[model samples]
Target: MTDTKNEQQWERTISFADGGTRLDKFWGRELADEGVSRGRVKAWIESGLAKVNGRVVDKGKYKLAAGEKTVIGAAEPEAGEGAPDPVRGRLDVLFEDAAMLMVCKPAGLTTHPAPGEPGPTLVNLLLHRWPDIAADKSGMDEQRPGIVHRLDKDTSGVMAVARTEAARLKLSADFAEHNVFKVYLALVHGVPTPAQGTVDAPMGRHPSQKTKMAVVDKGGREARSDYRVLWTGPRGLASLVAVRIHTGRTHQIRVHMAHIGHPLLGDAVYGPRESAEWERRPDLLAGLAPRQMLHAFYLSVFHPETGEPVTRWLPPPEDFCALLAGLPRECLRVGVVGMPGGGKSALMRFLGAMGRPCFSADECVAELYNPGGDGAAMINQRFGGAYTLEDGGVDKPGLFAAMRESDQVRREVNDMVHPMVRHRCEEFFKAHRDEPVAYAEVPLLLEGGWHKEGMVDLVAGVRCPADKRTGELRRLRNLPPEILAVFDSWQWPEKDKLAACDFVADNSAGLDHLEREAERLDAAALAALADRDRATEAWMDGLWPGLAGELDRERAGGEGPA
Candidate 1:
């Protein structure tokens, strides 16, 4: 029926040859030799030990699709004793009153015991540490004892446990009435648009798969969750989001996030797979997350005995923080803007040599003007193909002539190309998110409003003196004097651009002088990035003082307790 690897555990992957068979029935027939009966299989399903296509399916009566892979991990010797042995370990006690206690639950520790499963769960440890909790008869099951609510085995966060029957009842009522508040920190695959919103949906057990939950229209209970994005990584690859749920349904955060197209990273069951941006970039996903990136970082509730408000919070576990560290941090984006011949490209080259990724708007435009490219297609559609070259490409000279002849034609081209150029620049930054700084050489950076659009973090203006401006233009492009004035007239004045920008490079000086300025700017940018990271850490520490000390001790090689 199943291959036994050891005396403690057994696992098997099976594919149904025929469709429409009940999952439990199929498992019962296959695992008969392993001494696993149909009833045991059902229990295991409810415990989320049975999976189909890597997703937990708790329903025994779920109809199977032909060739669907079903995997079952079963305990070798089924659980018989109702009471599990006390587990001796360290507990992260957050807050404790006479009525209730709050603690930080670590990942991989079950909140309670279940049939056919044997392990040192959170309850077992709690019982060992606080023997009085064992005497409290308030939980739904004897194994749970004072456990008022539960977190998934893989979710690490602050949890409340009742110390007495009165506390348990009050806390239960508070949870049922949606009085307790929970703030979860999750790292999701994509940045949710608008940064913050609410999800109001109905949730219920899957009609066929009894073990799994889904958003349903009929016979489902009301569920609501509010979320806001805290930070986004390069190219919107991942986001740190805060989630608050008014109602606790099974897998509510995971399911609701998947529904909104920004599934939590590393959540195999409900995470995005087919539509994931990092689907093809295994290197980027590697070391990103080992488990679902969800943590119950904060919880607030009324004291069961005194009716006083109590709040407790914990910083995310080491793994969760590690995952965040592995991701690319927000890189400093610097936009280089100036008149056509004001040495923007030279400055970009200097920065690029200094290990900063740089984007050239002219290069991007040239790439887009290739035959059959998006820019070429749009240009042809809008201009009746009159500016197209013999090779089905846009003739740059012809387009320039058109721009000079008519301001409307110039405006139309600018409207179309500026957006394309900006998008390309954005992708460049995303691709190099790991870098400390990046530069975009945009001739019309100010005119296009790239800085205000949140596309760039800072702007560097190239200022050239009036006498040297015409000489520089002659040396750079050898354009006619009239053409130079026209191009220069179109751009913001040197003083205005410099005033609006965070930094300015005097291009009137030679290459040596500009290089020195570039180096200074590089150091300043690096320091700014470090300051930002420190500020973020300070904010997190302020939010969770208890966890901050724990993290400090952990970093200092003090593994305080289990």
Candidate 2:
């Protein structure tokens, strides 16, 4: 093979062993090391680029004779009239082969230049890097060399481009025949009912707007899209959806989704004026979208040269993830409760050390008892300075004594301080909304009736050997044996506490074992959170139906957490 500035040339003489071989097969076998396919060789032969005995033989089926010199010449792609100019810019090349190029086009990049649009499109970037594709003008639009399909300028994801003339023809035909598979991810206004359905509609240019595409009743091209609800945001504010298109048309997804009254979030053209309405909702993220929330998440096609399947999948972009993070979601909230000396705080510290947010009602109450705190102010206002301290804080010891003397005083004090602690817990949850799991140490979780208040998603009760709990109480607090009995009487029995819990951990083992239990709890809590995440659940169902139940049964039948 000889390479020139404008063309590539290969010369060979037929051997007696290959005398009866077809011309195309001969070149294919000889150029096998060059990665040229037999189909591509046949095209070259039929295009008059192959010659035998110094005469052009445009028939790929021509039988070759021994000692006949054959030459196959192919032109290197070159810039032609009306070709796009090469522009240097950042290009995210995903996968590349001799026949095609798969690239991840970022949002805000035009796939190709058009009138009144702009330069420096994806085509220009391809021309700048893979200059050989410039002369492969076999696409429907000559200006879009090597481009077999396109994504909207503001839409982001994986795309495929043909790098050679033969590849261009093959890919174009594949797309025209709807042989390529495409799946898009999007955030829409509301969850589509029935969870999954298809939209078969005809699309064309809008009747009144010349630039926009819409569902038309007459003289429109056939378009169909299948969509499945991935997950719905809190309060039906928004939803993540997956859409698969059977026929590619201009703005097919946007128009179809809007036609069904579920316009994509941030689609200013086809969407309703819900952005203005969403401004009133501070918790919803629909008002934060800078552009349409649509992504070409996955694509699959047959290899232009090898005929094998090629696929690419791109994750959501930064902006898309930002909006997703802004959506209201529930983090796994686990409330750890047990007797005072049962290592509840130790477990919480272990969870905190592992990067999960841990909250303590006792710590919150301590903060509330600080000077000028809400709990102190409420006590002072309601008790007429009887329980007020010199620093304008509540006199906790005096208040407890008074509460022991009077049931009404105890009820009043509980009403004043419990709400404050609950408010602090709410603030902690809000601050750590992005975290996967959080822990709260509430020793009176069941006695105070907060366990049934739906404050936490899971309740974990810790139990220690009776002697261990008694020893810790004696050593830590120097409490009298009578006080220990009174403390035990204030809460439920150990067995009852365990029964009320969703899960339990034994603290009879030392702190090292307790730390390992915390690790186990961390995994279990996160797994529970993922199990509740509708998007993840829906995705798992789509990928491996019934696998979750199988895994659940396996875990259930296996040993308990170590």
At residue 107, candidate 1 shows an lDDT of 86
In model 1, the worst 10-residue window by lDDT is 1-10
In angstroms, how far off is 105's CA in candidate 2? 1.0
Model 2 segments more than 4 A misplaced: 1-82, 136-142, 283-288, 328-562
Task: Give the TM-score of each candidate.
Answer: 0.74, 0.50
The TM-score, computed over Cα atoms with residue i paired to residue i, of candidate 1 is 0.74
Off by over 4 Å in 1: 1-82, 97-100, 115-118, 131-142, 163-183, 187-200, 222-246, 257-262, 278-286, 300-311, 319-328, 543-562
In the range 1-562, model 2's lDDT, one tens digit per residue, is 1112334666554545667899988888766545567888988898887876445799988998754556786742222444567999998887898889899999999997554455678988988898877654433333566777789998999899988766866776576556777778888898788689999999876777856888978767679998988778754768888887888788899999999888987887888586555554434343578788999987778888887767667777889866865675557788888876778888988888898999999888887888988888888999898988999988987987787678798778888888788878877865665678878887777777777877788899898888888887467777767657655765788888888988788798888999998998888888888777766545534632243233234333632100
Looking at model 1, residue 290 earns an lDDT score of 67
Against the true structure, whose lDDT is highest?
Answer: 2
Model 1: per-residue Cα lDDT at residue 314: 80
- The C-alpha RMSD in Å for every predicted model, in order, reads 10.7, 16.8
